[model samples]
Target chain A: MASSPQLGFTTASGLEQDLAKLIVDSLRLEVAPGDIDPAAPLFGDGLGLDSIDMLEIALAVSKRYAVELRSENRAALASLRALAAHIAQQRTS
Target chain B: MMRSTDSQMAPVPTARRAFAPVAAPAYPLVAHDSPGCTLAWRRDRMHSVEEFLRSVWGLAAQLPPKRYAINVCKDRYLFAVGFAAALVARHISLLPTCRAEEPLRRLAERYSDAYVLTDHDLDTSMPSFHVTDHARHSSGSMKIPFIPADRIAAIAFTSGSSGFPQAHAKSWGSLVLGAKALGRQFALSSSPPRTAVGTVPAQHMYGLETTIMLPLQWGWSLHAGNSILPADIRTDLERLGSPAWLMTTPFHLKAYLSERTALPGLEGIVSATMPLTRSAAQEAEHIWQVPVHEIYGCTEGGMLASRRTADGDAWTLCHELRMRQESGGTWVKGGHVGAWLQLTDRITLRNRREFLLLGPNYDLVKVAGKRASLAALNAALLRVRGVSDGTFYWPDQGRSGNGRLSAFVVAPGVSRAAILADLRRFIPVYFVTALPRNATGKLPHEQLETFAEQVRHSGQARTIHECRRESFETEARRGFSQGARRDE
Candidate 1:
């Protein structure tokens, strides 16, 4: 289990939980959000997502947090945990 | 028979005139102080067409001698001139059928030392030439060497949705003549004030001709890059100013119209690549307050026809080409008489100059010896209640045995039973198979081929019921998990 942060629901784990669900819903993922391991890849082997899915997720993230996601950068951080962190950083900034 | 040596080296007078720049009084052709094609990268520095060509030539001269080169730039000016320079330097330009990695690799193997021309710096193993640099200079205008009019100048690759990407060669003289016909037909002589803004890549036929070739041969300004998003398109159009024409596809046009945002002034919108639905065209015209012109062309024939309105069925053939259907219900023609070409489309010729295309010939499929059109099947699928966008994909098992068709659909609120119920009305029980569509509303041919191979090896007839059952279950689990996460 990942360590929980000080703010209770504001922790990275909490953020990942919310984000995983959001991504799953937006892309119509075949697996449960909980079943999506935070560290596992969101594309290819782990989630079987493609470029179109990436575009959708990028649009969803942009709409939700008012943050723009560059497609070229997405390949490096296509994981639930990384996405959550990116979103959280944007929210704070 | 002593073949005249002059025929090989002599420039066909008619063909030479075809390559001449059209005289446009409104947009006068002016010389730039800078050299090469300048892509507006920043506010201060813009690359010139002359300079861009020089850079490409400089790079090509330095690289090891190669037979073929493939350009993948979205920019028309860069792609056209880059291609021209390569041909002028006596190298072949291989246009691959698909941009997919596997097909690209295969094509690369077929053509030795093939280089990919791109605008942005790409970190790949393939040899690449970047024309973005402004410093490079090319040699002076040597007399245009005469290659046979039928000599292959550029090879265009197809979008391999159904199978492996196939290569189609376009000759210099033939391509030039085709552009001349298009320019004359569209009255490009008047210099339509509308700067060309393309939503599709110049790598494709429609984009290559309308956006790139038109500008190069006719001197119309073209937008520098591919604008995919609706907002980006709007921004680019506004920046280009009045009398702007959008060269785009049906897919992007649908999305653009759906955004419902105030668009800039437009002279016209050219659509191709996929069939444009009547509803989509009407909505676009309504939204933009301009005519949505439909271009009926493919990778093989280049620009064939253009219709001003979506409902308009008759397509005016390009000035030089004549259309006649063979006795076997296939479109066959010989005018312009460059290459013997057979089209994959079924067209109805109203006369010598006009015709109405009835979709692609291959789009028709046979199930249990009963022929059914895939276009009709997919059209029925879209008509289902709550279905937003859908495409039908024939599964691998359907190749050998008596296999039914399968479809992949995207419907937000529609249930599986509701969709099945709707489909059952049009298609027979045996005809309906499994439909699996990818996110982009396109099926990967590789995946289908793999599935076919698996079926052939296993010797199992997978029922449509099994496929649909799995699809429904997957959708349900996805929906449930998504709902649960959102609730938390």
Candidate 2:
């Protein structure tokens, strides 16, 4: 199961915070890392990243997390919390 | 034809089915029964040729005797029936890009006498048939409809860059013969029976050729309907019972690959509508565990060349077509290509069999699968209300995975919401940033990201389109300096 992306969720782990920053920086998102509700959907309506953004995010995850972001693993992208969990679980670094 | 990377649509030999010549000089385009082969698959059952022809005849009897009929049957199987029925009744099939009522009405009105033939439940009271009613019609006999080779089989319309859609008249011979060539490319002409499932709508030329014509002429079965979601596609494929081929677009293919659902094993994925990015294609092959072939063709040219995207960038020309690169475009002839047509894509010839797709022609700007002229988009933007003067310039940033065109708008008193909502009704745009023009009346393309960044920083972006420039046209020309962004 994917982890929840919330401010207080998962004890606000340093890795999650780090992943959040990575996403914002990679996407050139204007929002502060703390402001982007970790639990919010990374795709439509939340941060509102489209498919192209997802590709860039995948590339970033591959570089930073040292994890292969397979196209089939969409659940890992559900939220920042989910992404952090994915990176933590799958990270080679 | 290049490689048999597919496991599903494999030329795993079945009894070779040969098309015997017609006794008469005049030939029937669609056969009532194509010599001991099933027509299509529906509800996990093989719909025999007799039943398929009966449905065609039943629909043909109901259609008003006219020169053309607008074919928009969403169901792939029904569309095949409608297409053949139109040919049987001596009515040409008129295909449009969208199934919306306005376009269909305009097309029907333009053609003088025509009716909508779709499976969808539409609200319009246009002279139309739902196509579902003819499924149970009895097969009276194996009577075939003979059509002259010169007759217009289908009149396909392409969405114009600026104005109304342009019509390309395709004769029965050209469409049929072209499908035969495409069949060889797909290994559809040979036996071992593969069922095709496509995501694209039936109206488009790609969909028409792959889903309808191929199934009708060649001995292949169709999945009966369009599949979108991964689960839905898997369900349909499972029903078709194996050696399934997916004829889809890159847009849908990307989405399908992203899904967590376990995709059913397939023979191959033949993608058209847009160029498949190498990464996307590789990812698809990785997940689906199958070869992904990308077809490079436009509505005007029909099916031209295909590339097994994962294998390499070079495209192998369709066997029947001959090509030569001359003066910035690849000129193609043969395979009933009508006239010697020049493709808008610039190609570098590698060998006799292959070439690489560099990009679209210098003038065309492609976003996602949709192609439009920058001049056209800019003109339309200026024509919108509440705009004294505005320029729509492409930005380096702001485009998302969906490939929506990004633009900078300079309209005062207009909210980004108002601009986007209004502009979307005209053209599909992704991100719109309202910016002030420089003193020289030129909008800075590079500063668009800053404006977008500012909008994102502020919860609401109600920024007005302001300009410092007193002299508009001179600065406008000077500001619009990007050669690639210029209206060629």
Candidate 3:
């Protein structure tokens, strides 16, 4: 069995928190955004998100930030923090 | 003008040779003759057939002695290479759509000697081979091996109505023939080689047929990236030198239409996995100035029939294939579909060459290309501990384009998230006191809908659509919706 993601750590603020909320809203996930581990993996065992969820997340991210989350750069989807960092980098670029 | 090898075969010791089985004919691994023709596109750079053959040989030499290879390469180029390498090494490629650990574990348990061939470092308990490491190795002989036509090349699995993964094996000849038929159906064999840019993963049967086999057989280049984003698709299309064919699904097409994504240099579009609405297909054709074709098939038989959805509803069967109605069901055979296979959809035969698809069978529900029967889902739900009685409801057929299945359960202590974990999908779960099952323990059509409507109103379940009420009235008046299951 997979382990549950660590919840209620240090409060996730900034873009990381916002992206987390976006994921929850887009996928209709049962967990709260603040409870999500910012550093935990977004796929596989972390939050148990599948490929469909990834597409939904990509769509939501594009709509919200206007940043195209190309699936080729898979590292951007490693975690909430990674995704936020990618968005920040893309915005600056 | 009849030619026979009977005289040549008579020379090999008549008594012993007569009892021995005839050898299956062998065909070259790569169908195209041109070595310089482009085979794959890794981002902006094009890789030639020479490079692809070298990679196949290089990877085949380095592969571990395993009977089956669970190929999970994300890049289409790498996946093609790994698949070909496995075939050359006399190993079967096991293609599973789901990459989740549970499904992988099931595959591992089923195929004991199977090892994972992946580009990334997968967190799997099974033995793994990093295919990308040897993808560029050119030291080995680049000779294109001739594989026996009867050799089992790959096994594709589908989530059966019984909730277990059902395997469908395809021989090398069947795959090659299927690709040829598909190309002929689209008249691609006669046209210049065009790059295939697919939004679907290469692991799926539809993807494997169009994006992988069609390219390899017809000497076309396949885009390595599996990007569905509008910006990424436009960029990829712009970078291609040759005209491209977009192998996509309705979901992606709808997204593209909504975003008004400009796809340039596209020769045509092929949509599969789910029914593409006619309006969407017409709109796509109008905007892109390319014909939009939809393929109707399953994992069991690849590329059975196709239709230009913008033109009409009737589907033209592939070359050399035949379909007939028998015992109130549609059965198809011929061409790459070796034997008669009953389709899950309720179909109407227009003539010998074409047919009109009514819809998927009452029990079958396809969401975003993943097919699962409501019975299978209910069985999975009942297996969950603390669940007493439950039934999965498919509310509207028209809304299936963006439909979300709702389930009603009688589990008092079981949390919603726990059930979702068991099902492995996020669905709206309505906790009910009990299912309104008839005396025969079957969920009647009308009673279930009334019960569901009452529960949706009384509970905290947010209405998914305002138009849902109208659809319910419309369905009730129809006496029986096309999506309704009679025996459930």
Q: What are the fnat scores of the candidates, in the order listed?
A: 0.00, 0.00, 0.30
Candidate 3 wrongly placed segments (more than 4 Å) = A1-21, A37-39, A72-76, A81-93, B1-14, B19-22, B360-375, B381-390, B397-403, B408-451, B458-488
DockQ metric for all predictions: 0.10, 0.05, 0.24
Residue B158 CA error for candidate 2 (Å)?
Answer: 1.3
lDDT of 3 by residue, B32-126 (tens): 56778888888879888888888998899889998999999989999999999999888999998877677788899999999999988777899
Q: Quick one: best lDDT, which candidate?
A: 3
lDDT tens digits, residues B1-488, model 1? 11111123434478677775553112111112223333322212344555444554565465447778777665555665567666655577776533546555677778767887666675467887775542245563322233445556787766333233557777765565666666676665423334677866677667777776665555455677565655566666666634567888765675566556456867778887656777788888887888787877767778777776556767887777666667645453443334556666667778888887764223535432223456656666666666676665565444322344655566756555556544432122222133344686555566655654454466444344554675468667676332111000
Q: lDDT for each of the candidates?
A: 0.59, 0.66, 0.80
Give interface RMSD, per candidate: 9.2, 8.8, 3.3
Better of 1 and 2 by TM-score: 2
Cα displacement (angstroms), candidate 3, residue B144, comes to: 3.1
State the lDDT of candidate 2 residue by residue for B109-168, as single tens digits.
789778777787876767787778776578534455556666677899875554457788
lDDT of 2 at B167: 89
Please provide TM-scores, in order, for all candidate models, with all chains considered together: 0.64, 0.66, 0.80
What order do you get sorting by TM-score, best first?
A: 3, 2, 1
Candidate 2 stretches with Cα past 4 Å from truth are A1-93, B1-36, B360-404, B407-422, B425-488
